[model samples]
Structure formats: structure tokens, C-alpha cells
Target: MIGFSCYLSEPADEQQTAYLKQMQQAGFTGVFTSLQLPEDDPKTLRQRLNHLITSCHQLGLAVVADISLASLKRLGIAPRDCSGIEALQLDGVRIDDGIDMTTVAALSHTMGVALNASTLSAETIDQLANAKANLRHIEAWHNFYPRPETGLDPCWFQQKNHWLHTLGFKTMAFIPGDAQQRGPLFAGLPTLEPHRGLLPLAAYLDLKRLATDHVYIGDPQLSPRSIAAFQAYTSDQVLLIQTQTADDRLYHLTWHNRPDVAQQVVRLAEARLEHIFAAPEPHHTDERPRGSITLDNTRYGRYAGELQITRCDLPADPKVNVIGHVAPVALPLLDHVGPHQALRFKQ
Candidate 1:
């Protein structure tokens, strides 16, 4: 199924409901929302999110929400303080920190929502296993860790493949490669229909070679070229091409002045593809890094301060301490001590 991230930005509940319904009709299987709670007042946040969850459930759509330690810290509470409320909202908790397992597990128990860890790591997997929590899935880019040999390590590919099979976890990998790279990646993993941003015509055609079960065109503003390309390639082969409204300030400045162009693009693309979904806005954090390095560093630190070093000072003793007993300085011993030997004896 395809889905879009939903941001409850509208002031009125009626508008929010209408917007969600529109998204549901647009072919989104799920919606991701951001519910911020006060650290000292998680109960209030829980109440708000509960309402949103109930609303989505009524629409017969799955809902996912973000729960971050930093967001809690802003409310002046720690993860422990929000455990009870988290358990109450537990459809999914965005795993931003390594220490959120306890709260996530508690929330999962109460709300029956599986945890979806974003930007996951080996350590996070171990933590989830230790907590005995069922992790829903991981959201990552396919070219996260670049390999020197193949540009992406086949070994890492094998590891993730094995891990997914053993752990029964789903992976969502986004790719923005040209047609050449996209074809092989998609053909290699038929089950993984990656979410991709805009690409050139050549690359888009390459994507057509493989059965593109799902496609996400991030640009809201419709371009003549993009619309034409969508119409040309997305016939019967592609499943869905989800697009968002281009109402942001940046989208207007960069793409075009028309804010509604995004919707127009999606509409046109859908007309061509037949299977298209639309959302009022994009759910992803605007703070997305340009590259994998930024994403990795944001999730993990170098641990420079945690590293330790050891050093030793050598003595300037002239006498040879070769024997067990300390001997008086002797001319013969000094003659035997060459420059190299003397340097070694200094230790």
C-alpha cells in the first residue's frame, strides 16, 4: 500500500477531517502525523493524538505519529515521565534516540501500535530485541552507506536481506538515482518499491522497465515536462504516483510561483497513471539532510569524547639496567651503548 505523511496544520477539526478523507480517497493506505506534547503535560498531547487516531480509524486508514525525546524535553519531561501516555498512543513511535525503547515498548503494550524506527542502526535493533518489542519497520535510503567497490556494498545488502528475513521486518528505502541505477535496484528486489523524488526522463523510462508497483513524485508543482513524462511512462505498469500540495514558501520560489501547481501536477500525473494519491502537504521533516552523511551524523555521533588514549614517558638513565642489579656507570658499558642502543635503553 502507498501512504503520505499528514500534518494536522488546520485549526479546525472539520478541515482536518476533510483533508484526511481527501488523502484516503487519493490512495494513501496510511498517514503520519506529528503530535507535540508538553514534557510536563503528556496527558494533553495523548488526548489530542488519541482523537486523531480515532478519526483515522473511522476513515479505515492506518495512522502513524512521531514521538521524539527532544520533543518531550521541550515539554520539560524525560522519556520515563511519558511512558504511560506513550503506551496510550502506541501505534508507532518515531525512534529518534536510542533510549526510547522503554517508552516505546510501554506505548506498544498500551496502544497496540508497532514501533517504526527511522534511521535505524545495528545497536537499535539489538535494543528492540532486548526489549522484546515488535518493530514495525525502518525508513531509510537505499544508498545510505556508500561502498568503495560497488558504490554500495553487496555485503551490507546481504546483511539487511538476512536481517529482514530473520527479524520479520519491513524496509522502506528511498532512491533518487537515474534510470540506469534504478532499474537494477528495483529488479534485484521486486518486493522493495522505493519511494523516489523527481528524476530525468531517461531515468524515469528506465524505471518503467521494471514493474514499478509504487512511485512517489515529491514535487507538488506540475511541470509540462514532468506531467508529460508521467503520462508517457505510468500506463498500466506503475501502481501509484503519490504527490503533495506545493504550498510551502520554498516550493513557490524554486519550482514556480503557482502553489496549486503541485496539485495540478498530481492530477495530471494521476490522469496518466490512473493510480495516484494526493495529500494536503508532505509529512517528512523539512530538516531532511541533502545526503546520507548528514542523516547518519544526525542519528549517530562520532563519540570523540568517549575515546581513550594512553602514553608513557621514558627515563633518561645513562647506566645500562640490563642485569637485575643496578651497576655504577662504567666506560665499557657506555662504549657498548651506541646511539641506537642508548635510545632503546632510555626506556
Candidate 2:
């Protein structure tokens, strides 16, 4: 499942509601919110939580809250008395530290519960099982590290996920958002340290490769371009790559990678078949770096009109014209494109 975050640090407003709807329309299925923010007023938290939940329900988005014993107490909701939680109509609740195993097991029966994936031990699993927890509704969610260099290591995360799967738990992780990053430390929030500065889509794809069942945006907002890219990828199976220089000849067309994938670059399937560009001489035969969008000239004989996006840096070639480069935000996306992958260029 794909999701995004919304926080209660401030009251919900028209803009926040619109953002939720916008994200829902863009193919996000769920939202992750926290009820334990240190700065929120107890009264205001209740009001904002109600507004957020109502909006999510109307939009068909699942709501999950990250909560702790103190936060629940501040709201006057007891650990055992989940009726208050149920009244909020949340699809799930994430249990933070200081919440006991019995409470975790109880909450599972009442609503979906997400345990910390990194710290959940075999002993705790045994304890929950012995407590007769409804394990079917349980999932493991990794925390998004706010501090730089503190995020989980990729290898260790993968190994932990393998074990979690063996114990029959689905896994979720977080990736940073590019637009309006969450503050305090205005750096990105990511489950994997290496993903901190990467684009959200790239970080998400990496998590998928690592066997994550769900991925959420750790920050509260995503740039409109990123949202559109996600919408295109999910709805039409196309990667919408933003370009630095708009080539009128190529920007309006949809391109596909060759079925027989190349080793160093993505070969455009239709480029060779179409007699589009004039039989020409290469003018900008500059060094073709990764993400360079190039078109072969007539100097290459039958290979003319072969358009490709370089996957790795290569020396300049007189036969190829570097027309443009994919926008830096989308450079990481090149690594995920495979054979026959549909790609569309956007300004």
C-alpha cells in the first residue's frame, strides 16, 4: 500500500483537507498521522484528529495513528478502553514504546496495530502469541529517523524484514517528501539513511525491492510533480520523467524502452522506426553522462534516429547528439526503468 503523512501539530484547515483529497486522487490509499506530538494542545489534538479522520473516511483513505500511553492519557483514553479510539474510526493504531505487550495484543483485536519493526524481538512475538493477540491484524512499521545518519542500515533492515516475514508480519517503511519537509531538523525523514536525500519515488522503489509491503511519505507534503509521477506510474504504468530542456519533438510523445534491454542505456523502441528528425550532423556531441537523452545522427548510418537515455557516463561521440538531460529529481528513476518500460517526458 502507498501512503502519506499528516500531522496534528496544527489544526486541520481547508488546505490540509484539499491535500488529502489530492493525494487520494493521486493513488495514495492511506495516511499515517501521529497523536503524540509534544507541542499539540490536548483539546486541539482531539479536534484536529476528528477533522482528519472524517476527511479521510469521506475520501476512502485509511487512517493510522502513532500513539503512546501519555498521549492517550492526555486525551483521557485508557489503554484498555479503545472505544474512544474506535469512535475516531481509525483503521489502525501504531503502538509506541511504554505501551505493554498486553495492550498491543488487546489493540490488535480492536483495531490494526503496528509494532516497531526494528525493535520487535522474538521474545515479544512469543509474548504476544501467548497473550492470544489477533495476529492477523498486526503489521510491523519501521520508524522514520529524524536525525541524519541514524536511519536503519539497508542490509540490516532487509535481514530484519526477512525475519518479520517468517513470523507472518507484513512490513512498512518511510521515505522522505521533497516539498515542505517536516521541521525541527528540516532534513528528510527516511527509514534507510542512504535514502535521506533521494527522491521519494526512488526511495519508494528501493524499499519495494527490499520486500517492503507498504511505503509512506515521512514528510507531510509531496511536490506536485512527484504526486503526478506517482499518479501516472500507478494508474497507467508509465514513468513520467521531467526534462531539463523541453524538446518539442519528443516531449509530446510516449516512448518505450526496447524489449531486449541494453547494458548501458535505455534504447527508445520507436526512435529507430520513425523517420522524425532530419538527417543531420551532431552539433552538441558533448560527454554523455547518466540521464543524458541522446539521438543518433545520420553519421551513424543505419543507427541514425536511435534515441537513448544514458544509464552511465560515457565519452562524447560524434554520432550522437545530447539533446537533453532528465531533471535531477528524476535521475534516480533511471535505475528503476527496465525492458519495455513506458516513459513520458514532461517539462
Candidate 3:
């Protein structure tokens, strides 16, 4: 199943609501909310935090809250803050700094949430594993600023692949800039042969196929032609999509004529990939909740609900509300349109 990260903006009540609504409309099930603790009183901060969680749950979104190690360090917080995990009932916590394994393990147990450590080294991985950190995943940050020369280095690529496999960690890689710039790297991989057909369907399909299950494609000025090409080529595969925005900007990198573009893209993808004939329509068990429909088809399930939409079938949503905003029309088409364009309407 595909997932999204809501890190382009900051957290707020209104932003959270809008983010959740957009995720549901887009058929996204998981969200990674970036956490930036407020400087208010701890009690007030707790209230705000609780409100954020409640808001996400109401929207049926799985919550993966991020706690930047760098931010924590800047605030002079201790590694033992991981023990304070019980305060926030998150599904997962992202330790976004290079921290020791023992600290990570302690935090994981204290919080009872999976750990996502970002951009670490092989030495770091071994140390974490030795310290018994129950890391759910690891993401390499190298791709954020991909240098063509560095990316094309066979020795570097081989070493990175070996390290990832050796660490036994699920990996996620981001592709910087346009898909065309990254297509060669994507096409160069052998494991991606099966997904070559889906290549022309989406921008950077080859990279997505070769990298981990999670792929980030960021280019503010991605053209509609490129987007159309991507959609046409990768109709068969499940892919997570997100609009890119910078902290200083109020709009997304990819400008659109309407807000529903993102939603439309998500809807079309869901309609195309969702198994129409899987099981009996999913019964509305308590687990399913109200205003939500879970459809089982293909290898994954399609969760459609007023509060959230998820393909992974996880019980929670992980989207975070960022401070930035994009034009309502700036969203991908999947957020606005339904299967076969039958449900095309404003959200």
C-alpha cells in the first residue's frame, strides 16, 4: 500500500483538519506528522498534542509523529526523552537524528511505537542493532540532494545497496528534482525489470522500483505532461504521492489550476488498483468504524472512510499538519476525482 508524509507544513488545528480531509480524499492511509514541540507550558503543549492526535483519529489517519533529534538536541533534551513516549500515543516515532542504538531501543520500548531512524551510516546501524533498537525502518537522506556524478557512481551505489541489505532494514529513498534527471538511475537496476512497464506511467518509476517500498519524488515545477506520462505508465502499481512545498512558501512546488488535482490523482490510482471483486464488501465491524469502507482486492485493501483512507490496513493514520499551505487546486488529481472520473467533484 502507498503512504504519504505531511511534513511540508507545521502543526495546527485547522491545518490538521484540512490535511486529514485531503488525505482521506486522496485515499492515503498513512501520514507522518512532523513534530515541533511548542514553547508553551508543558500542560498547554500536552493539550495541543492531544488535540492533534484526536484530530488525526477523527479523520481515520494513522499517525507517525516525528521528533527531530536535532531539534531535541538544540532544546537540550536528553536521550531519555524516549521514555517520555507514553505522553503521546503515537503509532510510530521518527528519531530524525543520528543517535545511539541504546537510546533508540529504550525509546522504542518506552513508547511501544516503531522507530524510524533517518539517514544513518552502516556503523550507526550496527551500533543500533547491537544496542537492540527495535527500528521499524531506516531512510537514507543522500537522495535529498542528488548529485548526478555521485548518483551515477557504480561503486557508491553498490556499497549503499550492500549496506542496506546487511543491516536487514527496510529502506526508503528520495529522488531529487525531475524524473527525467533520475530515470537513468532507476532504469539501471535489475530488480526493477518487472516494473519497467509502469515506468512511463509515472515520473521516476524506475527509481521507485529499485529503491525501497517508499519513494519520494520532489520537483516543484513538474509538468502536467510529465505527470500524465507517469499516470499512463504505472497504472498497475501502488504508489504514494505528495505535493512538495518549502517552509518559506505557502504554496506547493507544483502549481495546479485547481486544488483537487492531487485528490484526483489519488482517486484514479485507487480506482484502478482497488480489487473490485475481492471479498464480500467489507463488513462494517467495529474495527471498520463508521463512514469508512474497507475493500479487499488484489494484494492489498482499499480503505475509504470519512476520517481516513489507507491501503496498508493499519489501524491508525500518520499524517501531520504542516504550517505551509497549497492552493486547493494545487493538490494531485486523485484527491478530487473518483474511479473512472465518475466521482469528480470538489472536496
- Give the candidate number with the greatest lDDT: 2
TM-score of each: 0.41, 0.96, 0.45
TM-score of predicted structure 1 = 0.41
Error of 1 at 48 (Å): 5.9
Q: If both were scored by TM-score, which would come out higher, candidate 1 or candidate 3?
A: 3
lDDT of 3: 0.41
Model 1 CA deviation exceeding 4 Å by range: 13-15, 36-51, 73-78, 81-83, 86-90, 110-119, 135-166, 173-347
- What is the C-alpha lDDT profile of model 3 across 1-347, one tens digit per residue? 23344442334567557645654544445555445544444455455557767777787766666666654554455656764554567766666555556766667554533333234566766776787866554433323332233333334544565576566655444333333332224332212222221232232444443445554332212234334333332452332233223422212122122224332112223322433222333233323211122233222333332112222223422221121222222233233233333221111
- For residue 83, give model 2's deviation from the true position in Å: 2.9
Positional deviation of residue 312's Cα in model 1 after best superposition, in angstroms: 67
Segments in model 2 whose C-alpha atoms lie over 4 Å from true places:
none
Order the candidates by lDDT, highest first — what do you get? 2, 3, 1
**What is the C-alpha lDDT profile of model 1 across 47-156, one tens digit per residue?**
56677778788888776555566665654556677564454443554444434666655554445343332245677668766887545443322322122123333345
**TM-score winner between candidates 2 and 3:** 2
Query: Residue 207 of model 1: what lDDT?
Result: 28
RMSD of 1: 28.0
How many residue pairs clash in model 1?
6
- By summed lDDT, the worst window of 10 consecutive residues in model 3 runs over 316-325
